[model samples]
Target: MKRRNFLQQTAMAGASLFTAGQSAAATPVYQQPADNPFNLNYAMHDGMFRNSAGADIIDQIKFAYDHGFRSIEDNGMMSRTPELQKKIGDTLQKLGMNMGVFVITSDNWHWKTSLTTGKQEWIDKMMTDCKTAVDVAKRCGAKWMTVVPGNFERSLSFEYQTANVIAALRKASAVLEPHGLVMVLEMLSDNPDLFLRHSDQAYMICKAVNSPACKMLFDMYHMQRNEGDIINNIDKSWEEIGYLQIGDNPGRKEPGTGEMNYKNIFKHIHEKGYKGILGMEHGISQKGQEGEQALIKAYRDADNFL
Candidate 1:
């Protein structure tokens, strides 16, 4: 394994242990004072800052908050122990920071279960998973959960596949809607074979579901890869988009390291009156604390355009 990946696994293992003793209501370590400039809506990914803080989740949260980040996103929020999830939620709420998106359908990717399969077992498992997501979301005070519909089934026609996806989402929406939680379908450009690849497709699905709880997680990195018109596509799907995720193209690294014009894009999103979190799902291209600091600076520069 690569040294960096090994180090990451080690750090996460250690920090996951440390969170055992901290009370859910413990005072948050990193609350920004009222005077900070960039306190609006930014998120921190768990693995990205592990190297900088020796795997302490609280320390990572504090570090991000002190540096002006007001939100944090953990894709594996449901996988953590209940105590840990409560602790994380308590810290963010106490610190006045928002909790960002967590996963609702992780097993779909892991077990190769496509919603387009139209099998009773897959539908049953997905509903059970949504119930689990609701419990996690309640504990973490999270309002948005990420959903991926999985790969396209080779046996199905394109139109049939679309209909199958819509049916699955509509069923998922039933559970999420009653709990006042929204499930944002992520359009991943990373996998071309996935059912949902474009903003328009996602928008169509969201409309088909016809629930306030169904929306799109418009990821800039993947969108930039799948389609080039980032700003315009966002505007076109503005009404249906519920959340945003960030990573620059070419490297999947920090925001400023690639070709996307984040400043202008952020400005456009801000102009549209978006009040949700932007999940910082990219990696720091450089090594050590300095590299992490550089990533922080990049967000500040891009976010300040507002």
Candidate 2:
């Protein structure tokens, strides 16, 4: 099957998890930022896919840059060829765009294994993988890498699992700290059956790791699904949140398409002086290049309220 078809199917399977809610507070009619002062950045995975039209990846980078996104995130960045990585890094640097989080964990596929297993072999492998990820980050000048602690260990006690995750992260932090790399633990919402499903959980994990190299990747859509208090939860966990991601709840589409007032959220984060990228890890509501252009327009429109 084509890659897009596969992704659509994957999204559909995860769609039912979101319970419907009120549409985002009516765009909060307001004036725009002076020449757009919001410092928001968007992830490139879906947006680039929509705009590229099978264009070369470099052209895809140009497409996103022209569209007003100041950043990009690739979950599969580690899998890209070294040459491709260098090329993307060079292009992004030239455009003055930031490289956002890429995956550093082993459980990226349809598997279940927590990094907190506390197994010597697992810990060693993770450190080795993170060391490699650090090299990629160095080349791309990326600061954040996504780290999913993996699925719940049913065989172990919850306390044991937490301890294991903490130990593993402590070891992982050792690898990233010296290089000024951060591992942002993403609290995924798709698998509620697994661990790390809420902002509080992520906050606790960050606190436990207790290192600048360990922080939270607050994915807004996921957090909205896992817990509804968007603003309050952010306030509570602000200190540990190292990165932010965007996708509205219900549809997991562009911001305005669902129940998220991305404008106010952007305004809040911007006003708070969050310098990190807001990864646009979402899908376009429409199809193909038209949808891609629409996504850009939607960001411009929503961000105008800033």
Give all candidates' CA lDDT scores: 0.77, 0.74
Residues 1-306, candidate 2, lDDT per residue (tens digit)? Answer: 222243445344333332232122112123233234335766676224432323355755665665556778777678778888888889889888889988886445213565656677777778888889988997776889988777777888888989998998998899999999999988877755567788988899899889999999998998888888898899999999999988887888888998889899888888888877888777767754446557777888777754
**Ten-residue segment with the worst summed lDDT in candidate 2?**
22-31
Top candidate on TM-score is: 1
Candidate 1 matches the true fold with a TM-score of 0.88
> Can you give the lDDT of residue 126 in candidate 1?
77
Clashes of each: 0, 1
Write model 1 residue lDDT over 43-93, tens digit each, in one string.
986756654554667778876776677899887788889999999999999
Which regions in candidate 1 have their CA more than 4 angstroms from the true location?
A: 1-34, 37-40, 106-113
TM-score of 2: 0.85
Candidate 1 weakest ten by summed lDDT = 1-10
